[model samples]
Target chain A: MPRVPADSQTSAGFDSNLLAFTRELRAEGVAAGTAELLDAAAAIGHVQWSDRAAVHGALSATLAKSPEDLRIFEVVFERFFFRKAEETALQRGEEVAGKDPGGEQAQRIDLEALKQQIATALQEGGEGSLRDMARLAVAAFGQTQGGSGVVGVDVQRIRRSLGLRSEPQPDLPPEDARAEGVPRDRLREFEREVRRELERQTIERTRSLPPARPLGDLQRGLPTGQAADLAEIHKVVAQLRRKLATSGQLLKGQRQSSAIDVRRTVRASLQTGGVPVVLHQRPKRPKRPEIFVLCDVSTSVTSASIFFLAVLHALHDSFRKMRSFVFIERISEVTELFDRERDFKKISRAITSDAGVADVSGYTDYGRVWLEFLKLIESELHPRATVIVLGDARTNGRPAREDLFGQIAARAGRTFWLNPEPKLYWNYGDSVIDSYSEYCTTFECWTAAQLGDFVDALANPRHLPPSK
Target chain B: MSNTPKTAEELASRLTADGYLADTQTALVAWLAIKLGKPVLVEGPAGVGKTELAKSLSRVLDRDLIRLQCYEGLDEAKALYEWNYRKQLLRIQAESADSGWDKVQDDIFGEEFLLERPLLEAITSEEPVVLLVDEIDKTDQEFEAMLLELLSDFQVSIPELGTMTSRSHPVVLLTSNNSRELTEALKRRCLYLWIDYPEAEHELAIIRLKTPDLPAAVASRLIELVAEIRGLDLKKPPSIAESIDWARALLLLGADDIDAKVFRETMSVIVKHRSDLDTVAERVGVKLDGGDAASAS
Candidate 1:
């Protein structure tokens, strides 16, 4: 017969303890599936059984999919596999009672020795012998499998084998009869605390996230108020001025400098034999033309005004003369406001506050604004100055003074209107744009890019070269 | 150089030379659409490369681009004409007509009356025009309807006179941040392409192209790290533009390799939102350097 170690299995190659633990795990909700069992067996076969971390990893990988699942596995694995050391002491107590019948002292010595052995084994890793002693003690002392009775054993024998002193039994209950110590109220409070903490953390996390883009940088570099698309418009404005300068078409101030003005230069040249040479040089008349800009700064058309101002500013440089006015509720002169470089934010605030305007009014009143502009044009505008009105003509049910516009057109060298609103929305509101359209020499859509192109065409005289 | 079918592979190679990388078939189509005068409507998340296509097209074409940024209440005059009032008045005074009404009317509404806005200018330009209509979806439905004529005919009709048509047709390019839906009429008028975020290899190529001076090892590592971060649920995934910014930041700091220390210092370059940074910090087992200085350890 082959002798087996006290800690070894009764039958070779049979892990009876591990099989018992697996059975308990299956009884609980944990499903140690066939694959997991196979993997566990193979892992245990490869690694040293004492390495607990490796075992834990192999089992966890086989069983768990998420954090919640891992937590469940930890609880179930601990309950079924990590047996408590004090369990053997309870078994030893039952053994002493059964062998010695009514002997309490014998039971105390046996229990003390068992407790010492369990503590020693738990501290170190050589707990196989202690596990065997626990099993043997339970088998010998336990009556029937389900019966509630304590067995008896030789206390001195147990004490000498393990290492402990005699002690009387305290009022300890049986392991099965002992109630779980966790308080229901304490557990519920812990759960509530955890939920509140999680809610707070979620709120904080959400608050820390950034807002959507585009909304954050809406009008950063757009043309608005005083700061127009100057660079883009200058090229066009210069061309127009040069075209007028070279044409000698007697454009307003050009009449005084016309080569065909024989009465003036020729009369003076008679003193030089009518050669018209070396006559007292005729003074170059300043080409200071008047320009009126009627911009619609209504909430719906504010962006349109920025591009108009850009073209106006560029034209001002080319013409060296212009009077600009912005209108939403009423027309107000903003030429001085636009002379400097001001961004939309600053100019928008100033315009709203009635800054740089003779009068302050809210919202675009196209009819009233145009009437006011017509009054200024007839009374103060030089006949030589060109009158330009910029607006979308959406007057919001207000009267459109088409007759006043016609009168201004009659008095000035030319009266022109710029409508930023698309033609489709022309007749929808107080948009008397169609009525005013009759007075405008040319009406076209003026987006920022288009405004720049138009100004460049006006500025560069080469495109519209001076007449031969 | 070869007369092949110009596959996505070929386009990708060309884009690499131009300092861009064509990652997906959609991006390749977008690149081709731009080159071939087809309008591309790129719609995606905010950080994705919708608007960047226009900028890159400007660089690639080497043309003076005209951009018409669309928004609420964007109308024709702002997009197209204004009259020369001062010049018209001067003309009226110079003519000295006894019948001033007729003279003013004719003078105000003459050739001098016409103001060439962007659409008209692009149409009339002798040189090739790259007209970028940016963020078209922001404008109202009526605006979209108005664009049909301009996009189809490259001409605008002024009822006062007749249709003003283009002498030189422009390469019409329109972009939408997709604030709202655009009209079907507008969509039907042109060829469409959509741009998406780059894949791994293309993203790597983009980083290399953008930061040519960066060491190859650093660029590759940065791309890999950013790609990994994108996999996580982030508030703002690192865009191609952001990736370039991050790579540049790293190169500026003299980091030839991406490591925990370097990444911690330059987290802001790639991860814009505070929440995104926190989430990334937690997921990657790193410390949030500033503010609370909390450690994952």
Candidate 2:
């Protein structure tokens, strides 16, 4: 037999590992197609195999299509390529040794000393030491002694015990922070490092996790309406809008009625010696659905309302007419704010602070707000209009305006109610979802993915539920 | 100039010589684009040097740069090619009625009357050129679809004339602000690279390179302040371009360190928005003022 190449074994291993990694990425929603996979494989051949950063750059640029995909690609690449077998074996050895009573007592870490080391690391502002300290903290405090034969990592508990919750202590004076030569932001960075290590440990412990959107998993506990979250939502909305536009499901009827463009026709006639033999027509504009959004801007449902407004703002180009209203106890038309400000942050701020929507207490009053909304937009309501109501349906035990909601549903061609709370939490406390949900279709839109599905359905009128 | 970079590291150094400090990812993607004869789709926030990357690549490759600035109604006539309509009309009027239609068509449709746009020029050029399609996200989907033939096959099709393929392969770069999602078809034809805000050390090096006269200490300090400001959740973060400007401004002012008073004067060099200025002055201003107090004590 002919002699094989020197690095044949390693190269074969790398190829198989890369193929598995690409499949893992696809299962985790990275959108890596065959083209990207081939590009990644070809790219790896060009870079030096020993140079880790170069290899990472090549694979990342070839495989990851978007910034979101890049993030998932990085995490998977790290876990797959650098599993640290030695560390795992070492940890397993420790676990086996600590099974005995005497060894278990010896393995116990001093909480006070660990806390002191973290404080010193924070004050010194050395990233290397801080990261080492985070790993130590995770090793000592992150393990959960479950009653069942299972080991789990709890980063939140470690954060609390180390007094590094990513949120600065409100009572700590700025002067003290300056004196310590380390700001609260530095501590926050250290805490993030700890969280990352804990996540890695969890992944190692489980050996496999259910395929999930990495973004959804990371931002599970994050409060909504953050700028980054808004950006992510904006991207997803843009994708949905593109899909709806490309499908042409909504533009079928409108194509036949397109008016001829006179200017283009005249211009085209010049090429033919001024005789208008061939007529040039304008591209038919789609028949756009009219939209009216009545959003609850009360403190309880502020997050959901912000997201709704953002989604509608992104989809404004696909609609013929649109209007927005923000309400706490009364309705105030704030469509001008959207028209005036291109920045979402400014629009959100104006809606919450200076839009002058709240006429009474801060509590949500659905009955009065719905009555006022009907009075405001009753004349403008038409058969082609789609009315969307965004809120938690938490009326604070106020009178439910079932009749007013029914009138809205009757006047508008379609009515959709998007509640930010989960289905289980719908009728638990002061929520009156049942009172008004009968008049319109209701969707639980607590996450961006749910909002995407709701908008996708809204774009296709045939999928809309019948209004009662 | 005739020598292309043999490796990503070489391409990165060549780009640095042209005053662009590209990270490993950017350099690798660009090198692959050259080696594979594909385009690079650069996406990021505004003011992050998406356009500058094209200019730098053109300079590094020693090729003429042809730019197509896309907007809301950008069409084939503006970006690809356009007929000299007025000239065509004049020629038609000048032609005698006795002359046959074939003669007039042959004369007018020749290269003399065909007005080549940036895209057509990049393709038909005798020498290779760098084609930059800037802010492609602003164009409508139909225009993007029109570009698919040109981008994938390096050819343009005209109804008046047959398809024209490029003899010299031009390096192509398309930059988008990501205002909207581009079609997947366009993305599939190019290598993707996202150039985010540079890290502190990387940005410091950029400042040092761009403004050599600025003191190293002052440049590092300015970059530190910029990083801290970016840490805050502002509507618009100061980009690397703004950071370099601020460093030059500080050098021109002959400032040793960034104190609160000095910062207030030169703050506009970095922060542009009215709201951002207020926030930066409050958050970063306190740190500088606190520093002043401690030194004085």
Query: Candidate 2, after superposition: displacement of residue B104 in Å?
Result: 4.6
Which candidate should be chosen as best, given DockQ against the real structure? 2
Q: Give the root-mean-square deviation of each candidate in angstroms.
A: 36.4, 12.7
Residue A452 lDDT, candidate 1, scale 0-100: 43
- lDDT (tens digit, per residue) of candidate 2 on B112-173: 78999999999999999999999999999999998889888899988778889997899999
Alpha-carbon shift of residue A300 in model 1 (angstroms):
54
> Which prediction has the highest lDDT against the true structure?
2
lDDT of 1 by residue, B178-252 (tens): 566666556545444444466666778777777789999988877767766875656577878888898888878
Candidate 2 similarity to native, TM-score: 0.64
Cα displacement (angstroms), candidate 2, residue B291, comes to 11
Q: Candidate 1: where are CA atoms >4 Å away?
A: A1-468, B1-15, B23-38, B47-49, B84-90, B93-100, B285-297
What TM value does model 1 have? 0.36
Models 1 onward score TM values of 0.36, 0.64
Q: Write the per-residue lDDT of candidate 1 for residues A1-468, one digit (tens) a residue.
A: 322223354323434544554555555444555433443444344333565654554445434322333445554555444232223433454322123222343244355455544434333323354444444333333321221211111221222233221221123333311112212222223222222222222223343312211211111222332222433344455565565465444444434443455467778788888788854554555445566666666555655655665555555555547777776666778777766644433454566566433334344665576577776656776566667777777665666767877777777765556566544445653667667667655455454444444443343323432221
Interface RMSD of 1: 24.0
